[model samples]
Structure formats: C-alpha cells, structure tokens
Target: MSRLRPGLARVEFYAVWNEVSELLNQGHTYRSAYEFLSEKKKITMKYDSFRRHVKAQFAKKKFMEIDSQEKSVIPADNKPKRVVPATATVQAFDSKNAVPLSDLLTEE
Candidate 1:
C-alpha cells in the first residue's frame, strides 16, 4: 500500500529490503548500509525513510543492547590510577635555589 517512486515496483521493494536486511545481518553500520544503498545500488531513498525500514525489519534491539553495555562499562570517576614519579615532580624552592639559566645563557 506504500507509495513508491515511478520506477520502484513491489518486487523492487522486496529486493531493496532483502539487500538492507543482508547488509545489517552482516553487521554493517546503518550509515555504511545507507551509503551502499544510495551510492552503489542507486536506491535514492532519504535517511529517515531508510531508518524506519531498518527499525521495522531488522535487529535494532541488538545495536541498542550493545550501546547500553558500552555505556555501563565506563566508570563514573575519570581519574588515572598510577601516581606520577617523584623525579618528574617540580618544586618552586628548588628552582629558586638553583643557579640562574641567564648566567649559562650569557656564558654560552
């Protein structure tokens, strides 16, 4: 019952869906599949329309579940674990007590 473009018949609709389903099943990203359909296959459909079709006929839940798992793995605190080496630590008093770099610059 859906209205398609002039050249897109019912059989073509099934064919396009078959291609979309195959690409998605093989773990292709939505953007990659969309680009393949548009650029290589010449499907010429808009983004939202393609997305709707993907959501309806494909494993959208799998993508969502994987995204949620990734989010949960990152800890709330973003602090680094290891302490910086004492040799690398800088002190103002050490610099003040040290011979001036200007003296070295003048001699050089």
Candidate 2:
C-alpha cells in the first residue's frame, strides 16, 4: 500500500499520537506534551517531526469538532454561556507583620 504521509506511516506514530492527545486533554501544551513523552522514553520521532504531527492532528480534530457543532440543530444565540461565581476574594495583609520572603524560602 502507498504511504499517506511521511511521518505517520508507522504504527508507533499512532501510539505517540494517542499519548499526545491524552496529554493535551490534561492541559499540556504541544511542546510540553511531546517533552513529557520524550522524558518517559515513549516517543521515537524527533522533536520537529513529532511537533508537526501534533499540530496537524490538533488542527484536524478542532476542525472536525467545529464542523460537528455547526451541524447541530441548536441555534448559536440560544446556547447558554457558562458563568462561574467567584469563590473567594483576596484580602491584603499588613507588610509589617508578614513573614520575610527569605525566611519563608529558607524554611522550605
């Protein structure tokens, strides 16, 4: 069979792709996702090749999601915007009574 792409031809590439996807779902950036896999010795492709694959996959998935959402029956104006209430507010403390930064650092 003829190869579809230069980098994703190998089965190993799919494994790496899945890992990158999972990492991204967990809030990792593309570079950090690949870096995590590299640190764990789970990826075989070089950084540039791996990065290209990630960007391509991410873009493809994003486009698919947008296409699907656009096809939904619900009108865009009817959709509810998510609103999160603030849980806590910061209170300023007196600098005179606060512990010194150097002391806190040394304690750790």
Candidate 3:
C-alpha cells in the first residue's frame, strides 16, 4: 500500500515528495498532509496508501525536520555516530574477510 499514485515518472514523484516533505516538516500529521494535498487537488490517495508511500520512500530521500534552527532537531539517541561529509567517498562495504561476497552485494 502506498499513497503515491502508481505509474508516475521520476519528475512526478519528486513533485509530490517535495510537497509532502514540506508539509511533514511543518509539523503536519499524515492525515493532515493528505487533507492538505486533497484540498490543493494534488493527490487523491487514501490514508493507508499515504502511510505506505511515506515508509517506502523514507530512506531513499532526505527528510526535512520539523524544528526551528535554534533548536536541536533530532533526539540524542537517534543521531548517527559519525556524519559522512558530502565530499567524502563512501565505501559500499568492507570486503576484509567476507564470505560469499557475491551473495552479500546488492546495488541500491
């Protein structure tokens, strides 16, 4: 189940994602976001579909936080142990002594 309409191209998907992200970052609930989108005549998907789409895309895209710049946005327990700089090259995986590396590899 996903809130996003199927058969949408990348551009269409990004359009909806941008709007939804804005709404969510502004402290709107999923229900409220749906209503807002419906009011704007952007999406007609149901609540369940919306929830699924949000979950599906949660990791694929950057999320906006609903907090002021002066405030600490994320909870301490949720923070990443280390932040990777944008310019740094990220290693896909450590192949130090992995067995059957072929089975462990999967392209994003």
In order, the Cα lDDT scores of the candidates are: 0.71, 0.74, 0.68
The collision pairs in model 3 are 2-49, 3-49, 3-50
Which lDDT value does model 1 have at 52?
63
Cα TM-score per model: 0.40, 0.49, 0.43
Better of 2 and 3 by TM-score: 2
Tens digits of lDDT, candidate 1, 54-107: 675546668788889988998879667999667866756776568788988998
Off by over 4 Å in 1: 1-13, 59-108
Per-residue lDDT tens digits for candidate 3, residues 1-108, read 354546443334356988888889999998898788867877666667667777668754433333343257556688558976689676686668656745668532
Positional deviation of 7 in candidate 2, in angstroms? 3.6
lDDT of 1 at 42: 56
* Per-residue accuracy of model 2 over 5-38 as CA lDDT, tens digit each: 5545345457767777778899988789777886
* Candidate 2 overall lDDT versus native: 0.74
Ten-residue segment with the worst summed lDDT in candidate 1?
Answer: 6-15
Q: Could you give the C-alpha RMSD of every candidate to the true structure, in order shown?
A: 13.7, 21.3, 21.0
Error of model 1, residue 87, in angstroms: 99
Worst 10 residues of 3 by lDDT: 61-70
Which prediction has more favorable TM-score, 1 or 3?
3
Of candidate 2, the 10-residue stretch with the lowest lDDT total is 1-10
